[model samples]
Target: MNLTWRSSSILPRTSRFYQKSFRVVSTESRKESAQQEQEVTHDQQRDPVLSEEKKARAPFLKNLFLGRFDKDVLGFPELNKARQKNFNAAIAPALKSLMDAVDPRRTDAEGTVPDSVLKELKNQRILGGTVSEDYGGLGLNAMEQCLVAEFTGSDASVAGIVNASNNMVIQVLFPNSISAVNKYGSAEIKQKYLPRLASGQLTAAWCLTEETGGSDTTMLNARAAKTLDGKFFDVTGKKIWVINAEKADLFLVFVRIQDKDELHNPCDITSAILVEKSEAVALSPCPSAGLRGAGIQNITFNKAHVPVEHLLGDTLDGNEIAFETLANFRCASAAQVAATMRGLLTKTIRHCIDRMAFGQTVADFDMVREHLGKLAVWTYAVESMAYLTAGMTDSGEYPDTQMECAATKVFSSEKMWSCLSECLVLLGSKSCSPKEGYEQYLRDSYCHHHHGGANDILRLYIGLKGLEYAGKEMQALVKVMRHPYDNPSIYMKKNFRGLWESIRFNKDNIKLKMHLYGHIHPTLKHISLQPEAEILERLVLRFPVVIEHVLIEHGAYIPQRQMLLRRMADCIIYLHALTAVLARASRSYCIGLRHANVE
Candidate 1:
């Protein structure tokens, strides 16, 4: 009998007698083939010409990487007045009641959020803030969702529950699936699911993470085999650390299609299926150090039958849906982190003011003040970026914000962990005690660093993705350089443009044209003249040049240099934060918000 590698039928087969001897060879060959196939698929996905033509608007940070500052992004975003009023009048009271009912210490000790609190959450429509009003939801926009997330995020467990439903499930379901009728869920599926989800009559879990495929969604081991009738799929696999698993009435599952033709490219083999809770679905609680009340569990699908219409998108569209969903989710998580940091800062400040130190309250000490100052600054920066990104999402101008969202998540999560650690130190032994709840906050913050995507991995993604775009832009320049004689006039034109830019810089013309000084409020004019602002301007001007040089130097092998990529990511993140801070401060000053000058 002929034995073949299951992943690809094109591979050469071997007799049963030689299977053991050729096992290593077959495995290695399969991996190499898979890698080659994946690269080609990714290259197609990253086609610059295609992307540029399809793009309706360029994202702020990505444009910065290309050395063009989008002046429009300089305007700070504000919540819609009508939405703000609605939130205050309706959602605020409900949120307050939910908060009042929740006891973090009790929730942690019992390893479960009380059912009463969950009911309160549903009654408040907190679980369905982002769902459409037509579907029995609040129909909050991106900025509004962020505001609500901030309130829930003060308790990490609650944030996890709400986000899992709103960000992952609702986001993926309606936007990607229903909105694109030709591509994803049928009308019947939408009618069946949306209203129930919005009413909180059903809860959903996003089940993309497998034990083997933690951060790498493409490596998912789950398989969905179409039954002979072709009307249903038998999904079989186990997903670990699935949030809302214990309570989810519906699950959005990602699995590889067990079809011979689709198996050739692993990247394109994944599909998403909606599986309603059934006897075929088994759940086992997976306890964690934090987010104990989040109802995280290991879920096994033992031949769970899902109707063909329940498929979220077209076959092999799982990766796209998953990524788009995650990008939005990560952007929103920054808001959660900002809220968590703000809460920690508030608690720390109150404690320092009341607790005595050497001669007076701890707040009187220079060291304590320094820590507080750092925490406050970071909190401000994170909050600024969070809302700015939310505004970008809400405007619907930029079709892609994957890189920007990743950068925000990385920055916010890290800063949250750092800020909480500082708070812990400020509170000393008291922080370690469960009574203070600082330790709980610290544990929850630590989890954010790895929640959506690990910080280190995301850093590489941010750097490499930027580099990919820069590299594409540099291709023409490289061709000119490689054979200057072949394209003398084109080369000379390029040279002259470079020379003109340099000359313009020396004459301060570039600075005059590119400066954001004109955009800020008159009262904040001095801020534009500050050294930090000057440094930011210099970095913005210098970054693209540095990026070009790095690409020229490293070429295709740059992804392997993790340290360099990390540094690149750090620089981009800092620039983004500085830009956000300036925009926010300028808006505050212009609006004459109280104490705006202090910002």
Candidate 2:
């Protein structure tokens, strides 16, 4: 290698002549070289301290990495921090006031939380976070939405007032479907709908479910056909459980486009646009055990004329749109439910401290303390996992998201319900009665199981996905163990520290797998299936391929020092589960500590 050194004085001459020479040469080549240097400098500026801090935080990061799917793929800290600051300053207070209004605390009467509550959220632009700023929406990131959802769990009904409207619209705005909105929906749709939908001027819903088929998009029975001028469809169908439908200004209805005279074609389901309530034949409210304030209704579209532009995406791609939207919805649902548990824990701790038994506070009892501890631990673990997943999404890591979303929703919902029950028991009779507010929390929290997806279905998904990852890691391990020469002990020792420093890296990946599966299996059944099994097999097969490439790329430079791979791997795996539990457990502790120390 040749090296040249120049002092600041010589640098001036070097720069002066270099600039003249560069001007004489091709400008494009110089621009390309400068751009490459700029990119390197930009990345360095983005995290000058990150490399150092990451080294110190290796053990913690490693803990997060073990035993879960790839979530770091979507982690976006810059966006997350920006949104958090905005919510704390702008949206949080507005939401707090809305919660107070519909709380039943002021009135001591029972009726639906009014549309005005949602209007207040709109007025504050809480419902527009996902919309572009140009459209009068907040345009917040995924983690920001997660934070907003957490704060709302302080009062879910009010959160529903805000989120239900936003979710209905934003759910349709990902990369794939935005084109449909732009092409088919009128310019008027963006002008009229974007601003209000962004500003909460009008709430919305997509009516797709039926009594016979909910998630099974192929089983859709609703039909739409072209009528007069190639721009309209006279549609008729019954849509069950349409959220925010009764009062929403718009409805995106999925109607099956007929294949000749067939009742249904798996690929023929198409969506129609319905903007007029009058055209909507009838909207009847559905009675519900929970989410009472949500305007969930059954809507009948009888000879409803829908505009051609109202058809979203391609006619046949309706099912694809629905599945993708549902996946995102389920992931967000996990974040929302985790917040509910945090809020419930706060309320329960206060009850335990204030409510006495045997001349001591209920929280003072051993069993009560143990229950609270467990709940706090579980809640923390859920939040950590949920936040990690949300961060990944905001960062645009989409591939590994499917499994993480399923796991987060399942773990959070099940843990929250259990936490809610413990708090109910601690509160005694008042928790069960509507007068005390605990019953309502219980009602709303339990309802989450049915909202995005049934708990059983989510469990099946988690079981299969977990097995798939475990299988991949195991196969990778076996390959490395067999080809010991490929990763010589000396090479392993050299890069050992750096590898351990990375939160995702783990050793004794086998022991970590056993520990993870041991806990996961009790919670889920039917883990062995061909789809997941094949995925695992493929992952295992790729282990040597990936290792070979890495070694060839870094050869002598690769680090291989090892200190506590087994311990680090174990910690990494357990910590992911631990953080979720701790969030649940700590909320109660915070509440109890505050109550006992204060009046």
Candidate 3:
């Protein structure tokens, strides 16, 4: 093999370029060119690190893989009584009046809410739902913002627009950036945008998703390089499909900000720059099938000059911000789905009582009752998942619930899809008509499947996450097989850990005949769906065994089997969502909040 070496100074780092081993053939022509250079093909490249956070599941989530669906192992995130005041005084009331004044059809057609209504929304502090009071925000926690998010649920576009601007930027992203800057950036950077962001004066959009690589933040075309003076960065690149783009005053653009001063560097270094939408930034609205009110657009930054103060956190903090925001976005998406499903329930019940069929009210029909019951269960489950997640975050039990959040989003969205379908079928042609709000709900509901990470992609996360711990164990076993004589202690756990755990678990299982009875929260003990719900619990318990077996059988090749992973993802979502419903029901029963109960 011929080798050539170049100085690190002159050599440029290329993206995803791998050197292939040369092959030799017996033919004279092949043998002659055996030492020929391998041409580098500029094919479609992928950044393995993009969305890398989704590659592995958190250890807490690994318990689910072990057949411990009882989330109490995760510190069993519950409602904290301390947050009652904030919920009662600000969040709940605001949600009650949220988006109530906006006409869905008119907003859908006109692509904007009434100024009067937006003013009312702002005045009520619904717009500042996620912001802290110090910066003129409502100072609500994740749970509080979730309540407000649920209020926006009736309309997907409303939720997308509001959540994108307020929740995505200020609620989740801004706070993280501020903390990072305070810890890493200068004091001036910390104080720069909080007030502007907290108050409704300035709106920011997340510019992580690009057309070339959708939701792939690693392959960013936009980049920033240090200016010769070392005071500013010359940022350039186009951002597409940014939520609230046209209306945004500030943009949180994700790109790789080059740092030449560092001695040693890690891979996957990206930065978030707070770019104001000035003349340097050109924006054009991107028309969509739904979310018209969101004002998503394609934005171009023609060498936008960003000062050091505008850089978010330290270098390489961009991925953290992106993932944090994405996690928050997933939680908000579930809340939105809950609200949407509830809205459908409200319209359905009202219509059922009013409309007549066979000279009898639709409510009197058995099929209607069945459909409504299913819808009610689904809506309850979604609301449960959303609130439980928000409460989990607020309680600070699981600060990083990447798997749980993604699971909630996928579950809620799929449920919402089924919900709207049933709603449309139940509503008949009236809903099929252009004027009905159901049409709008159906359109907006499509966003759930595609945005906040697509369900197909997210499902792979669930399947893999559930198998993460097991795969690690498998990795240990493989290592031991490769070096059997090296260390008995190292391979001991790999060799017999499962057997011992299974024995211990089986003993515990035998000791406790009824798993659901003891695990059920006291608050939820009163609600008796035990016969059916318990069946689900037991069946779901078996998932870990299946997952363990799959991981053992496939070993490291499991990632390539995304089709199987997606199916496993579907199962895990339903199981996790079911448990979330139980958790939410227990919380509601404890708190006496009837707003989120099934029966």
TM-score, one value per model: 0.85, 0.65, 0.79
| TM-score of candidate 1 relative to the true fold | 0.85
Name the TM-score of candidate 3: 0.79
Candidate 2 residue spans exceeding 4 A from truth: 1-79, 104-109, 174-192, 259-267, 270-276, 461-599
Cα RMSD for predicted model 3: 19.1
Candidate 3 local accuracy as lDDT? 0.64
Q: Model 1: per-residue lDDT, tens digit, 197-263?
A: 8878988999988888877777889999889999999999999898889889999999988543544
Question: In candidate 1, where is summed lDDT lowest over 10 consecutive residues?
Answer: 1-10
Better of 1 and 2 by lDDT: 1
* Candidate 3: residue 61 Cα off by (Å): 2.8
- Give all candidates' CA lDDT scores: 0.74, 0.53, 0.64
Which ten contiguous residues of candidate 3 have the minimum total lDDT? 1-10
RMSD of each: 16.8, 15.0, 19.1
